[model samples]
Target: MIEIDSRAFGNKIKNIRNSKHFSLRQVSNQSKDETGVAISPSYWSLVERGKRNIPKPQTLKRIAKGLRVDESDVFRMAGLEAPTEATNLTRITSSEMVSVPIIGEIACGEPITAIENVSGHMLLPNNLVKGGDYFILKCIGKSMEPTIMNDSNVLVRAQPDVENGQIAAVLLDDDTTATLKRIKKTKNSVILMPDNPDFEPIVLNEDKPGRIIGVVKMEMKMF
Candidate 1:
């Protein structure tokens, strides 16, 4: 097994994060908002400063996306030449922080308010969850299965809008309901799609009415 010095790995990640002109919080936010994974600014700071080593493959993928590089790059920076070495872990803190649950989005059949009532859930270990601003949500159906599995935990942010091709939590004109779906906006209308093939598409006439909450940050599953 290849030994990865935590400090060296942290330094490389820090260098890339800085070169990208992105703050630790900023990257953490994006990971939660776009990919449905969560990370904190403080932990990211430590990871970049060579004070920590990452062990999860999913997390590496999120960091890779956040950094706009291939997944292998994260390993290379961490001083690992193989995927197996990436699993060797280390920590910066003894006590782990908590990440709350977020459960709302486009194509989601549940009421938005229903998901909000859940209390602050301290799940992922400090080493795994990474410290940051994040919330978790429950997935109801299989429309997003294979992409987002049923009974999965999704992380989300609170924002008023999103760009094209991003998954969002949308509120239809029906005041009592909400849906979680991927959105594509055109000049005439908004296209709402379900990740699964069994479902049909929903078109929102821009001239009519609709609301967009934040984008989907992360999707997690518990075995």
Candidate 2:
């Protein structure tokens, strides 16, 4: 929701980009890992020359990271209250970036990042993540629709458990299959509830238990 003086922002971005000898194409590719958003070089060239403005803070953050420049420095050029906003959003000050693997269904029988399971990788801001194993899961099926669109990706923090009523990835079929659901633990069984009312929830009991793959941290469209 931040407004930008596009001309001034463009000059600053151009100067820094030139100093670092980065091509618009290179920056575009580098930025994909940072935000998982595809950047078009043709459009970005216009952005660098004062002809266009960055549409949102997220794109600005990606370009800043791709330039290896501290975002606060760039934010100031746009007259933004970087510190207050970044803190509130858990955005980090450090320029460090972390690459998180994008994996398919995770089952207890297979390694979390098994070569076959890993489809790709996404770069995340270091400060945005806390200590723990992290991975990106591709959303599938319509059970989680409306809340999570099919084919989108969810950032997951690998963990053994999640609180009741929280959305989590669960491994069933004796840890051979995985599914996404909102869990509710009853007195003697666990219910895997879906956001879509059309789909029925699955109930698990002591005889057939479900293992938690991880709780979802954020849902990403990757557009």
Query: Which candidate number has the best lDDT?
Result: 2
Each model's lDDT comes to 0.64, 0.75
Q: Which stretches of candidate 2 lie over 4 Å from their true place?
A: 1-95, 105-108
Model 2 earns a TM-score of 0.56
Candidate 2 local lDDT, 1-223, one digit each (tens): 3566788788888898899887786676556543357467876788777787654666677777657677777777666756555464654444677888898655457777777678788788876567888888887898976456577788888898899988898788857577889989889988999977799999988888878889987676464
Clashes of each: 25, 0
What is the per-residue lDDT of model 1 for residues 1-223, given as tens digits with 9 covering 90 to 100?
A: 3577878777777788789886676576555524355677777777776666565666676677556576778867655564553464545353564555544442344444345444445455554455334556566776664456566666656567888877776677754345668888788888888876798878888565777755676665443
The C-alpha RMSD in Å for every predicted model, in order, reads 11.6, 12.7
Local lDDT at 92 for model 2: 45
Shift in Å, residue 55, candidate 1: 17
Worst 10 residues of 2 by lDDT: 85-94
